[model samples]
Target chain A: MRDQNRQFRLAKRPEGKPDHDTFDLVETDVPDPGPGEALVRTRYLSVDPYMRGRMSAGESYADPWEVGDPLRGGVVGEVVESNGAGFEAGDIVTGDLQWADYATAPGTALRAVDPDLGPVSTALGVLGMPGRTAYFGVREVAEPGPSDTFVVTGAAGAVGSVAGQIASLAGARVVGFAGSAEKVAFLEDELGFDAGIDYSATDDYGAALDEAAPDGVDAYFDNVGGPITDAVFDRLNVDARVAVCGQISLYNATERPTGPRKLPGLVSKRARVEGFLVGDFAPRFEAATERLAEWVASGDLQYRETVTEGLESAPDAFLGLFEGENVGKQLVRVSEPDE
Target chain B: MRDQNRQFRLAKRPEGKPDHDTFDLVETDVPDPGPGEALVRTRYLSVDPYMRGRMSAGESYADPWEVGDPLRGGVVGEVVESNGAGFEAGDIVTGDLQWADYATAPGTALRAVDPDLGPVSTALGVLGMPGRTAYFGVREVAEPGPSDTFVVTGAAGAVGSVAGQIASLAGARVVGFAGSAEKVAFLEDELGFDAGIDYSATDDYGAALDEAAPDGVDAYFDNVGGPITDAVFDRLNVDARVAVCGQISLYNATERPTGPRKLPGLVSKRARVEGFLVGDFAPRFEAATERLAEWVASGDLQYRETVTEGLESAPDAFLGLFEGENVGKQLVRVSEPDE
Candidate 1:
């Protein structure tokens, strides 16, 4: 076991986009597991867009990480030392853990991940929180029907990619809006999406969306909210459903930004907009995981990871999310799991 | 019977607020009813905020009124002449009719008003579209819990007034925001609302809303959408439900107005916002009306009307809706019913 542990702690609350100054890396002794806890050796640390929300000093569903506290998010690690029952050494697990080489968590909080079910890192991506978010948002919130047109923003991101794939599998014509031509090509060429629009290249987003979704949008999975979302609202068909999964576009705004008033459009379309978190579906997590695993195994669903090589690169990896630098799930590899 | 009928025709679509130039008063010969039709003497003409949407050439759930077309709205009239089944002179009936002293409509489009239950004019007010709107909004969309703090904007207007009353009777603590001090008093003192804020008297709507709903808002019934809506979005509690019933505040804007982006609030609260029209509830109208009538009879759902006395005052009555002139349901009393 490594005697020294590397940790990234929140140093300051960012007013807008976070910089290197927002986080501080410190070296400390590896944490020892207390009673009913297990010491996990980190393999991969998940960097997500929602983590930006926690970096700000405000109300969020997830508790804000105060300055001097270690940043916490989805982490897949191996149980190297155990002081609790049912958790044996060498067992792979995932949980909301500190960004450290070693994290000690209550045994009850960590869920075991089977290595045979693809790479265990997937427990942090697909077959995990992002997967469940896409599953529930598409099925429960959006409820896309066969022949319906499903439009997803942030189409190449972790959650948006999974959401688009699921909607396509449900027999809906899927149209996606991504940042680049490459991401757009990935959505249409690899994911069976009916069409993909490079939102960054378009000035008239509504017209672009209208051309892509000629029948109008029946279900919208919004991960990036801004002009793209505004355009989607204008083209919503009657009884449309919008799942407000993320608003990465407006997360860094120093003050409230305004767009075209959308309630009027909602009334005309008789639409519904709902925002949700994966934790809201805790009871059905196992069921969702099983279905997601089946899809991954059957080659029906595919995922990519933009991996940063070291613990020191975590800040750059996270910041890259805002710049649209990463494709699919972004992760920081802290160490390799023991066989 | 008068041979000449006074009609208001759409002369031009107004740029902002409609004026005399937008409406042209015309004199026409009263037409006889054809088969399955009835010629009725107009009694009360309903002037509502939604009519403003129809005046514009755009997409709305309600079809837009074209130039040279007579203004049509919900009207309660006495059947003076009939050419259909269940024909009877002096029968009070209600249907969507033109802004004229006398009009002809298919008998099937008109429903006989049972005066014994309540005022026949209620077929256009509390027991009609607005009431049904409030009913479904609270029960179907907002779904307020007995102990929840239910906040409603435009609380003194037609739909908001009834929405507040219904939420209050459902055992929710109802708080309202209105345009004037008198309307605030009308909501709290006369209508059984738990609290009321005169939005016109306060610049900080969020502060006023917070003071009234100290426990945080569980359900918000939005009618006049704008900054008031922006304020409510800031304080939404977990699983909050918002029923988007109207955007009367922005109805007169020549251009699409931009306000604060609100999807982030929904994410933190796991909230829902849905838009609906009463026409969507046609299949359940009978059940809703019966329940509403019982509430009215029991004094649990009292209503008030702001009546303009002449047919010539119809356009002024509608324009007054934008100015927040009418306290409750605004109507034009074209003529009196024969007792």
Candidate 2:
């Protein structure tokens, strides 16, 4: 085991889009596991769009990361050492941990990663937070009916891909908005999405929606916000439901971006727009994860991963989320699990 | 009995605010009652903000008025003649009727207005559409709890006045935003709102809210959806619920106005914003109206009205709504009931 650990720290609050200067990588002594704690070597670090919110000083669902504090997110790792905790050495686990090669966390915070659930790395993707988010967001919030037209933005991203598929499984006509033709192809050809629109190809999203969602959008899962959302709001059918899962488009905005007022439009449609966090459903995580695994095992659900090669690539991987550079779940591979 | 009927017809769609040119007053012979219909002499004409949406060429929850159609709205009238319909000659009734001295309609489309429910005009204000809007919006959509901090915009207006009081009755701290010091006094003094912000007194709604709703807003009932709503969105606490009741501010806008995006903020707060029309709760309207009437009868609720003396003033009364001219319900007294 390495005696030294490398971790990324928040260098400063970003003004807009985070650049290389926003993060500082430093070498430090590996944290020792205290009583009821475990020392885990990270195999895969989850790089998500939501992490960008933590880099700011403003209040959000998760507490902001202060300058010089180690950046933290979901990590799938192998436990190397345990101190009076319910875990054995070499056990695969996942928890909210520092963006580093190694992290020490209370054993109570960690969950055993079932290797049988596809790949161990999936503990950070399909069988994990993103998957559970899609499950609850679709079932509880969006509630797309069989005759409903379900529209999702960022169709190729981690949570959105699963959300569209889940809506499709519910017998709704699922339409997705993706940045590229390849992502559009993935949604329609692989995920069984009824239709897909390449938003990058047209500035007039309303026209694109007119073609893909001819009947108008009844349920919308918004992972990206901006003009795309404006267009969706314009075409909302009566009694529509919008689950605001993420706003990757506005995370790095230096100032609040102004858009056409939407609340007024809601009155005519009698629609609902709700924002939620997956952590709010932690109590049901186990049951939801099991359901997700069952789908994956049955070939009813599929997922792709864009893995960055090393821990040093974590910042780049995260920045790529805003750039639409990753196709599916963006993960930073820190190490390989022991055979 | 009057031999001539004076009616207002939509001459053309307004580009911004409707003016005298938009409506043409015409005098015509009163139509005889058809089978199963009654001839009703207009007594009171209800002028409301929602009417503005119907004047546009664009589609809305209510069907738009085509050019050259007689302007129609809520009206309280006395049945002069019944043709095998369920009404006596002297019965006071209310229904969607024309803005004319007399209108003939099937008795099935009209509801008898009980004079025992305060004055007959109350059927157009506190005991009518506006009151029922407040009832369902607060009880079903906003759902304020005992510990909640409720904020309402257009607090002295018809729907908002009742909404704030209902939230207060639910044991929530109610703060209201109104246009004038007098309206603020009506909200805080007469309606029992905990605090009132005169929006016309300051441009900084957020600063005013910081003082009035220091703990942050938990439930919001929005009637005037512009800067006032933007301020409330900024101060929303976690799990906030926003009930979008009306948007009088934007009813006359020739083009959509832009404002700071609010959905992104909903993510951090896990808030829900829903829009509703009172008509959507039609099945429950009778029960809801009874509850509202009970509140008014018990002196738990208070109401005000700004009545125009003549039907000739109907267009002006409606235009007044956009200017924040009415304190509570705005109505035009078209004729007097016989003793």
Best by lDDT: 2
- Each model's DockQ score: 0.86, 0.90
Cα lDDT for residue A190, candidate 1? 86
RMSD in order of candidates: 1.3, 1.1
State candidate 2's TM-score: 0.99
lDDT of 2 at A273: 97
Please provide, for model 2 over B1-339, each residue's C-alpha lDDT reduced to its tens digit, 9 standing for 90 to 100.
888889999989999988888888899899899999999999999988888889887888899999999999999999999997799899999999999999999999999998898899999999999999999999999999999999989899989999999998999999999999999998888999999999999999999999999999999999888888999999999999999988888888898888999999998899999999898999998998899889999999999999998778988988888889999999999998752
Relative to the real complex, the DockQ score for model 1 comes to: 0.86
B1-339, model 1: which lDDT tens digit per residue?
Answer: 787989999999989988889999999999889998899999999998888888899877789999999999999999998897365888989989999999999988898888977988788889998899999999999988898999998899888899999998789999999989999999988998999999889899888987999998999999988989888888888999999998888988998899888887788788999998888889999899999999999888989999999899998998898888998899999998542
Q: lDDT of candidate 1 vs native?
A: 0.90
Query: Model 2: residues >4 Å from true position, as ranges?
Result: none
lDDT of 1 at B193: 93
Candidate 2 chain A: minimum summed lDDT over ten consecutive residues — where?
A330-339
Local error of candidate 1 at B215, Å? 0.9
